[model samples]
Target: MRTLIIIPAYNEEGSIAQVIGDIREHAPEVDIVVVNDGSKDRTEAIARDAGAEVITMPFNVGIGGGMQTGYLYAYQNGYDAAVQMDADGQHRAADLPKLLAAIPYSDLVIGSRYVEQTAYRSSATRRVGILFFSKLVSFVTRQRFTDTTSGFRAANRKVIALYANYYPSDYPEVESIVYLKRRGCRLAEVPVEMRSREAGRSSITPLKSVYYMLKVTLSVLMSASRVRVRGVKTSG
Candidate 1:
């Protein structure tokens, strides 16, 4: 199957090269597409040097916008599957096969921290918010989710088309899960270990984290009321 590993980068020069190189080594055949989202640094150059087919947006469009571009590219190129991976070093390339294996049977496969066992460590406050989001997903989708904030995920053509057509503009990680589920898209998770960022401070500072959680929760809760999920299946 044609697979695209879409890396959304924003001022991620420090870790972009490493992330791309690791993916190339582990999944050499998988097409790497780096969406350089208005980075002020050399993120695009580094990604290019690492052999990723780069897409440079004129300005920083944030995570959701960058990801949508990837989806659009996948749809246009006729790719069968696409993986959303963060440019930060937190996500591992080694766990890609499990995600790929599940994508054929499931519309979406999330690289989860608590699927089979908990192997992730983060701040306590962050954990609380994540747990809350997990419960919220379960409530909305009628399926228990282990990780709602994970960016490491793989989606088949159907899910890719959905995102390309209509994607949440801001804070999409949790909202997209609800959107996919409403469409009757099957979802699964694989246990994957996450690492600390190799560089850069997170957008979610302690003070900002509180506000982000509140804002995201309300937005998702409101959007869920209007979402419509289509049952996507392969034509035989």
Candidate 2:
């Protein structure tokens, strides 16, 4: 398959190059694209020097917009599949193949850290948020998901077109799964070990974490009842 790895970065210069290098070393057959979300640092330059295509947004559009940009690019450029990974080096490039391997059986495959429990660990606050969202989504979608907030995912052409047309504005990971499930898209999760961030810190602060929990909860509930949008046109 013509696979593209999409890394949405916001001032991730600290680890962008290393992330690109890891992808190239582990999944050289796939193409890479770095969505620089109006970063004020050298993220774009570093990603370019690392030999990945760069897509720069005018301003910080946040993860949702940046990710949608990558999916839209993949859809328009005739990529058969697309994988979403973090730019902060938490996600392992070695897991890319595992995600892609499951694409043939699923419309969207999520690389989860909690499917069978590996070395991945999180803070108490973050764990509560993750568990809450996971349970919320599993209840609404009638499918168990251990890592609903996981950004590490691979999507086939069908999901590519769907997301290109309509993606959530922010904190989209959890709600997106419910959105896809509501549309009858098949989803699967594979166990993957995630490393701690090599540089920089998480964007989520304490206050934002509270807001994230509430906002994402509402989004998931609403997404479950919303009608599926029409798929956008894609070229060969």
Candidate 3:
């Protein structure tokens, strides 16, 4: 199947080239697209020079908007599947094949850091939030998810079309799991190891993480409460 690797970058000039290079070295067959989310740095130029198609947004629209743009591109261009990855070097390129391999049996496949009990450790505060959301999502979806906030994910054509039309604009990864569960989309997880960021600081501070937890929890609850209507159509 034709797959597009969507790398959403925001001021990732320090790491974009290396990330793109890794993807090329590891998953050379899959097409790559870097959605530059209004970065103030030279991220776009670096990605373009590295031979990945670059899509620049007018302003910083967050990860959700950047990913939606990629889904739309994939949908329109007839890609059978698309993978959402980070340009910060946290997500390993070697795991792309595992994600793609799982796509045949599931509508969505997530690269989970905690699935096999790896050495990947987060801050205490972040781990608490991850555990909370993992339980909450498991309860709501009736399926256990070890990593609810993992951005390393792959989606098939149906999901790509669905997300292109109606993706959450903020804190989307967690909320998106609930959304897909509501629609009866099959989900799967694979064990993958992630590295610490090679460059650039995370946007989520300690205080912001608290607010993120509260807001995303509320969003997931609201999403779960909605009734699933049948016959929803999406452009292929």
How accurate locally, in lDDT, is each candidate?
0.87, 0.91, 0.91
Give the candidate order by descending TM-score. Answer: 3, 2, 1
* Per-residue lDDT over 71-121 for candidate 2, one digit per residue giving the tens place of the 0 to 100 score: 999999999999999998999999988899999999999999899969887
What tens-digit string does per-residue lDDT give for candidate 1 at 139-182?
Answer: 87789998999999999998899889978877889999988776
Minimum summed lDDT over a 10-residue window in model 3 is located at: 227-236
Task: Compare the candidates by TM-score and give the number of the best one.
Answer: 3
Residue-by-residue lDDT tens digits, candidate 3, 115-146: 99897877787788889999999998899999
Candidate 2: give the clashing pairs.
none
TM-score of 3: 0.96
RMSD of each: 2.2, 3.0, 2.3
TM-score-better candidate, 1 vs 2: 2
